[model samples]
Target: MAEDIEEHEEDTPTGRKKGLLIGLVLAVVLGGGGFYAAFSGLLPIGASATHAPAPSHNADEVAFVALDPLVISLGPDRGNRHLKFAAQLEVEPHATASVSHLKPRVLDVLNSYLRAVSINELEDPSSLIRLRAQMLRRIQIVTGEGQVRDLLVTEFVLN
Candidate 1:
């Protein structure tokens, strides 16, 4: 009976050790795969529906054009809410002229879109990300593909 008890204790520890080893190996492999995916951009950290990290550009080859700040009234449900937005368009240095020429159309598109949005949509914190994407798409359509690199929202205030 004493020999049987000793054998049981010895067997239990071996099984526990083997289980622990397998768990460790799985943890290492999963951790490595996560790192690989993140670094490879397969999993983008902090990316939003409307925003992504700008692609690399040579310093001398990029330019930014500021737009006039827009103050638009939100729909009446919120009792006199307003949005003040300011942003810049990034473009290739040579395309600055073209983008600048289209500035009026860009503002018109933004104004019309903002006015159409309800105060409730503007109130949600996540809405800014969606709004940014919508605005960027509209601006790009006006500016033509490849003319605008990115939209940098410098300020967004709701009052």
Candidate 2:
């Protein structure tokens, strides 16, 4: 009986090792296939569609009034970094002239506010949004309500 069992065991080479190798090969092939499919852009289901392209607006509906660039010195010692700020005001086509005339006052307000801001706040990445809102509010106040629509920051560099 024992000799018969030993002979049966040696007759076929099917065991855990063969099944494990087959499973591993199958997994690797499927994984590679999936990667290639996604990378080739053939799998549209996996593609992201979170945002849509911005629609074109009426060009003549709004106009931008550009302000002169300002270079504000930073730090009390005056040997430290300086801020170069440039921006434009979005207003109706008719308000452009009025906004342009008040450009000097706008620059003064912006320069004063920027100088008063701490260096740490200026360096923070998230602080830009808050800073923009504050600056916009100041600009609207200076230019009077309904004259300015938005404040678009074109350049903000600290060196």
Candidate 3:
């Protein structure tokens, strides 16, 4: 009986050692994987020199960027229950060459769009969501297919 008890105690230590070895191995594997993932280059860097296109101006270039429209409420109270805003747009890099050709159409679109806006819509931040979509659509219509890729509001004044 004494010999059997000693044998059982010896087996218990061996089992514990095996369990500890397995746990250590698992920990090392998980730690190494986590380190590799942390160091991986999966995040995106937006609008940097590395991501943006190279700058160049050639004869085919068309640079006609009108100043942002002056937004004002044509009501009695300009400050109370009313807001005024000014917005400027940036021409797409690729469509820079064809921008001047479509200036008249672009101006017409801008005039119509600005005129259609109301003071209430300008005051609400949520209105900007629909406004951005509408602006992009209007610009696309004015410029025509593939002429403008993005509309950048360089200047935004809210009052």
Candidate 4:
């Protein structure tokens, strides 16, 4: 009975702390080993993903065609608020001449669309993204598919 009691006393909270310390050390060592294995390319996952070079966007593959500046008149409620907008079209190097030939048509679409948009919509800061997308779609319709990659807005100001 005395031996059993001594055994129970030794098996209390003090022994639990030692087990917890060993577990924590093992977890840290294993975690570090796994990280080193992945980082050193011994493991198949992270090394290639982290160290691979990014694809470059060469200027030769794309070209920008600048549009003539546009000045749009805001209607009656806002007195003399003009939205001055300028943009460039990003297209394949081969498409520049064909796209530029259609500039008048593009301008007509932009002017008509901007004139139709409400003053509130023009004044909102975040509306540029929506506006840019809308303009790009209209431009693509006018220019045809695969001609325009993107529309880069160089200037947008309302005064």
Q: Each candidate: RMSD to true structure?
A: 6.2, 8.8, 9.5, 9.9
Tens digits of per-residue lDDT, candidate 1, 1-159, equal: 999999999999999999999999999999999877876677744333335556878889889999999998875776778899899999878899989999999999999998898777887877787788898999999999999887889988899
TM-score of 2: 0.63
* Candidate structures ordered by lDDT, highest first: 4, 1, 2, 3
Better of 1 and 4 by lDDT: 4
17-113: candidate 2 lDDT, tens digit per residue: 6888999999999999988887666674343322225546598788999989999999767568899999999987888899999999999999999
Reference-based TM-score of each model: 0.65, 0.63, 0.45, 0.64
List runs of model 1 lying over 4 Å from the truth. Answer: 1-54
Q: Which TM-score value belongs to model 3? A: 0.45
Please report, as a residue range, the 10-residue window in candidate 3 with the lowest summed lDDT: 41-50
The clash count for each model shown is 0, 0, 0, 0
Candidate with the greatest TM-score versus the true structure:
1
Estimate the lDDT of model 2: 0.86
lDDT of 3 by residue, 1-159 (tens): 999999999999999999999999999999987666655623232223124463564635533355445454445554433234334445656766577667666656765675567867766755665686687788887777767655655544554
The deviation in Å at residue 127 for candidate 2 is 0.6
Two-way TM-score contest, 2 vs 4, winner: 4
Count residue pairs with overlapping backbones in model 1.
0
Ranking by TM-score: 1, 4, 2, 3
Instruction: Give the clashing residue pairs of candidate 4, or none.
Output: none
